[model samples]
Target: RRSKDIRFAFDRVFNEDATQEQVFAGTTKHLITSVLNGYNTTVFAYGATGCGKTHTISGTPDDPGIIFLTMRELFERIQATEEEMSTDLSISYLEVYNESICDLLLEDGGRGRSLALREDQNGVVVAGLSEHHPKTVREVMQLLLLGNKNRAMSPTCANAVSSRSHAVLQVNVRRRPRTASISSNVTVATMSIIDLAGSERASVTKNTGGRLLEG
Candidate 1:
């Protein structure tokens, strides 16, 4: 008997032993630089329940994930060029639950009403979504923790706290050069970090009836 072997091509690959920093350096490091220069970027996670999406994107405080690492790098870069540029940063967090969009960072504490989607020349955006301008890493962490607490969740057979909704964290960074010129263009860019709900089979999650539909 003979066996066939196959080869695959990829921009980058990581092994189990790879650290969180290594992953960020290889995949997301360049995006930060581009974002600083006025380019929008989005990083999302997708897979089945019990997969490593949560672990990779929002790891524990001790091991920090991409979001926190990215924020740290962004602030560092901003500080490094403070003399040459002025930057403004704002953030908004939203969750899609049962086809409804809810603002996670709403002043009313993720309550009130569901936000509406609107579109114009730029693209589709959540209408009247709450935006928070956080100045420091601590403030950003506070908003992140608040948003996480607001995400829909229910105990499942596969996991204790299974996320029942998709959460998106968006950051808008606007930069302008200090020196004035005839064509001093302003740069506005955005970064969206999404933590998507994982798929769970009815058999695996042991959901049934109305619960099955919800799952």
Candidate 2:
């Protein structure tokens, strides 16, 4: 066999020994500042099956991950500026499965209904998606847990309880001067955190029909 070389570049790279905190700091910490400054930000994890994407995005209670750390920092910054700025935080969770979008925050996890996407001045959005205003990090985490329970999951030969869809959590932030006049402008931004489904190979995963289609 002939040998070939390929080179790739990234903003940053992590080693296997990197802790969750280290990963978040290197990859996502700066986005918090952008969100606070009224700029949209997004962070997503992609990899092959059982590669720790889920763990990094949503770590266990004892070892909380990016979601928890980000929320905690966001709330802290907002609180620090509460005297001068009034801020509102709204969260929406959804899943993309089989090329269909479903609201994971709904009572029944939006079963039997495929949501439509529409474009507005703010860009693309999911119509009829529910948004919940969370006042504290704990509240935000509670919502995350609920959404996770509703997320699409299934067993696969590559890994049991594999996520079968892409999970997206959007945090919308609106802020305005606390003492601003009626004509004052408000700043709006969104921070989207996504846990993408792992890439699959049918030959290895042995997925069939729906699962294969999803992959």
Candidate 3:
């Protein structure tokens, strides 16, 4: 027999004992500051089926997750600087399934018209997608709950409740000096938190037809 060695490097690695807070602080906490400084940021998880992608992105109520933690810190910072900076926060959630985009924030469970992607000055964006202004972290979490309820899910041999799509939560932040003149420039940025669908192999997941195609 012949043996070969392969090595890979990463910025950081976490073990099963690592708490959600530790993971968030080490990996994603810095992005919140960037968003406030008018820089776009995104955090996403990708891996094979049943690898804890969803659990890391959206944890249980008792033990919250990255989304909740990020929102809490964002709101706290906004409140602390309310007198110096007037800020606005808006959020939109959507999913990509089977190469199709659906607005998860839609009242009709994202089954209405199809959404298209277009590029603007900022970057690529979903055209005609709905956006909601949330005043507090609780409100933003409510919106998240609603969107998750509408996300696509299916059963597979690898995992019982497998996510069938990529779920993206977009938070738009706009800020201006509270005492600035009307002509003063306003800083705007977007933070995207995405939970990607897990990869699957037909032999392992036992998927067929549509599910297989999604994988």
Candidate 4:
């Protein structure tokens, strides 16, 4: 059923008053719990360029959004269960620009790298990105901040600021087998949070900067 809001001509789910924290709380409970069934989940934000997509994903350091909240909750759960089970956790963040993949961490000597995911009869492989090892929640948060800085952000009218490219955060989880005798029963899971490049209405933007050219 479609209800028309003639003023905007489109139905809107969230409005300006929505807080980043509120959004995070909703997603943390829903998405993080489904990670155990060999499934992958993505949270995407789409709106005109200059909209708050970037803010929605990676809000200012003082303000935390879904990405931060999700990471914290997920890792916190993992930590809580550590006493009874053995697990290995790894996490990494990457940026995609014009179809190119760049490493957010280890940039000192790393050249721009491209990442890919391909699967055949066996499984999926994210090319150009090796599995990252993240032990504590704090460590992952640090890497996220580093990655957020490396992302391409610019000013716009749709919002005060916006994201120009896609950003991806990947967390990999592997459970240690009860023992070598029961190693085959061990399970693995992965979760990805993607902050997408906003959908910009060129005319509304006035299209001056490269954004105009790209759009």
RMSD of each: 3.1, 1.3, 1.5, 4.3
lDDT of 1 by residue, 84-126 (tens): 9989999999998777789987655456588899998768889
lDDT of 4 at 75: 76
Best candidate according to lDDT:
2
**Please, what is the TM-score per model?**
0.89, 0.96, 0.95, 0.77
Q: Give the per-residue lDDT of model 3 (tens digit) for 36-95.
A: 999999999898889999989988898888999999999999999999999999999999
State candidate 1's TM-score.
Answer: 0.89
Best of the candidates, TM-score: 2
Assess the local accuracy of residue 12 in candidate 4 as a C-alpha lDDT between 0 and 100.
33
lDDT of 2 by residue, 1-215 (tens): 99889889899988999998999899899999999889999999898779998999999999888899899989999999999999999999999999899999887899899899999998999999999999999999999888899888989988888998999999999999989997898999999999999886778789998888987
Regions of candidate 4 where Cα sits further than 4 Å from its true position: 1-16, 108-111, 120-124, 156-161, 176-180, 208-213
Ranked candidates, highest TM-score first: 2, 3, 1, 4
Any idea what lDDT model 2 has?
A: 0.91
Q: List the residue pairs that clash in candidate 1.
A: none
Total clashing pairs for each candidate: 0, 0, 0, 2
Worst 10 residues of 1 by lDDT: 105-114
Ranking by lDDT: 2, 3, 1, 4
The count of residue-pair clashes in candidate 3 stands at 0
